[model samples]
Target: MSQLMSIDTFLDSEEVLVDVRTPSEFLKAHIPKALNIPLLTDQERAEVGTLYRHKGKEKAVLKGLDLVGPKMSDIVRSFLEVAPKRTVRLYCWRGGQRSQSVAWLLEQAGFKAKILKDGYKSFRRWVLNHFEREYQFRVLGGYTGVGKSDLLQILENKGAQVLDLEKEAHHRGSAFGGIGLPKQPSTQHYENKLAMRLRAFDMRLPIWLEDESRLVGKCAVPEFLFQQISRAQLFVVCRTIEERIVRLCQLYGVEQKQSLIDACMRIKKRLGLEHTKKAISLIEAGLLDEATLIILKYYDKKYQYSIDKRVVSLYLNGSEMSDVQLAERLLNR
Candidate 1:
């Protein structure tokens, strides 16, 4: 007999997690570490869905059985490889027929299979609702090249609760952020990953986050969490333009010059045509520091505009303080 369990119970258990949704569905968003053992292919699921809408549930059931019959042995073999313990936990989009069917099949094959009570949909609800919970957020606000991300990493190593949103999004929250990063996860998946991390955090401790606009590349910060960040304590870091230019050159200088130019062109409208051309010319001349200074004009102005709208809790001059010293101040504050 298959048992249905709450999402919390499923998360706490160490059983092999199986997602029986189609590959496309799994790709968009899924529980972390859940293996894809799709009961139907993308096309097959679509075909069945269309039939169910046009025909009745009886005809749809018959069609589904016909399609799945030949694949039973293969499914069993695949499950056996991943589930050496012969114990499994699985879910579909909803705790519907597809998951129930798979659970029944596994049971008949002499395996213990438990189903997630409301399936992936329930997990998603769990993910979204997590952002609404209260958190003590410490937002690190600074202009480009101020080393905010670096400091956040140090804080994490010092045992502070930190949410590295850029790491999760594979973006640094800048026009050039995506130049050398891995492909960004879909926004849905980004939320899923963030929620998973948040679930493991101790809520009593302050969560350090790099200040960002709502969107990081293609991923939008969950709205409720973003609101909390906005109202939470803000710490701004300031550094000289020359200092920032040197840091920017060091970070981006190794990338292909063409890639750098393409990044500049992306913000051409905001950067202005004349400034954009000068930045491109500097890049071609291998004067990365000069190019960065030009780009910083736009970014610095934009950052200051955002900072002006918020009440800053503290400001640290990066020119005077080492990153280690600054981190200590933040940690001890």
Candidate 2:
């Protein structure tokens, strides 16, 4: 006899959260920091699902048992190794057989195991609902190379709530975005991360975020999130084109030459072949300043297009001062 619980019931509890869904499903999105102790492998789960659809529940249960029998001891060992408290909360796709069966097994092994009332699907619903709520977002908008990411970090250090979308997405929102970073999370996982971050913030205070397109690398910002940011207070960080170009070079100059050239080539159609060739040549020749200048012109136009589309609330001149000075001004406001 196990207790059925909602995700919120134990999300911050001392009990360990174990996702009993298959690894692939867990990888796409699971409760943040939840351990994956799958009740079935991807192939096994598929087989069970097919059997359930065509044959019947009895056949599927039998097959699932067969697949899980040999792994029972291993599962127990893994669960205990990770959960020192001897209490575990389990969930699968929809609080279905997989999670129930795991709960039974864990309980039999002398660990207190509870199942989520509606499982991971329920958690996902909670996540989506978070975005649907109205929020007062303090947006930090700027052209490319305005050091917005650095400023967001500064704001965070000063106790302001800041969501670094680029950092979370492991991208800088450009062709050169992936130059030196880990692989970005799947869109599903990215949203999961965002939902977690959203809950952590105090809604009474303004939440700071960088203005971004719907897309960041391979990850797309959820529609409700994009909508709120669009409607929120929008402020631009103004910087000189020359300064932006210099900043771009500082950021990308240490990157490998081939990486820079590949990034340029990625936008060849937009850059035009002649400009692309010139940019690549300059980068290869170690004249990174000249190379970045050409790329900045293209980026500046693209950013201006974004600006033109938005109803900007204010534009803060940050070119003449250090990021720290700019951060102080924004904080006072």
For this target, which candidate reaches the highest lDDT against the unseen true structure? 1
Tens-place lDDT per residue, model 2, 1-333, is: 788887677565657889999999988878877889888989998999999999999999999999999999999999989986788888888897888898889888888888888888888898899889887798998888888999999999999998889988999989999898899999988888888898888888888889888999899999978988888888899998788888888888888999999999999999989999999999889999898888888888987887787788877898788999988988888
Each prediction's TM-score against the native?
0.96, 0.95
Off by over 4 Å in 1: none
Q: How do the residues 1-333 of candidate 1 rate in per-residue lDDT, one tens digit apiece?
A: 998999899888889999999999999988988999999999999888898999988888899999999999999999999998889999999988989999999988999988999899999999999999999999999999999998998899888999999999999888899988999999999999999999999998899999999999989999999999999999999999888888888888889999999999999999999999999999999988888888998999998899999999999999998988899999999
Clash totals, every prediction: 0, 0
Q: Which runs in model 2 stand beyond 4 Å of their true positions?
A: none
Cα-lDDT of candidate 1: 0.93
- The residue pairs found clashing in candidate 2 are none
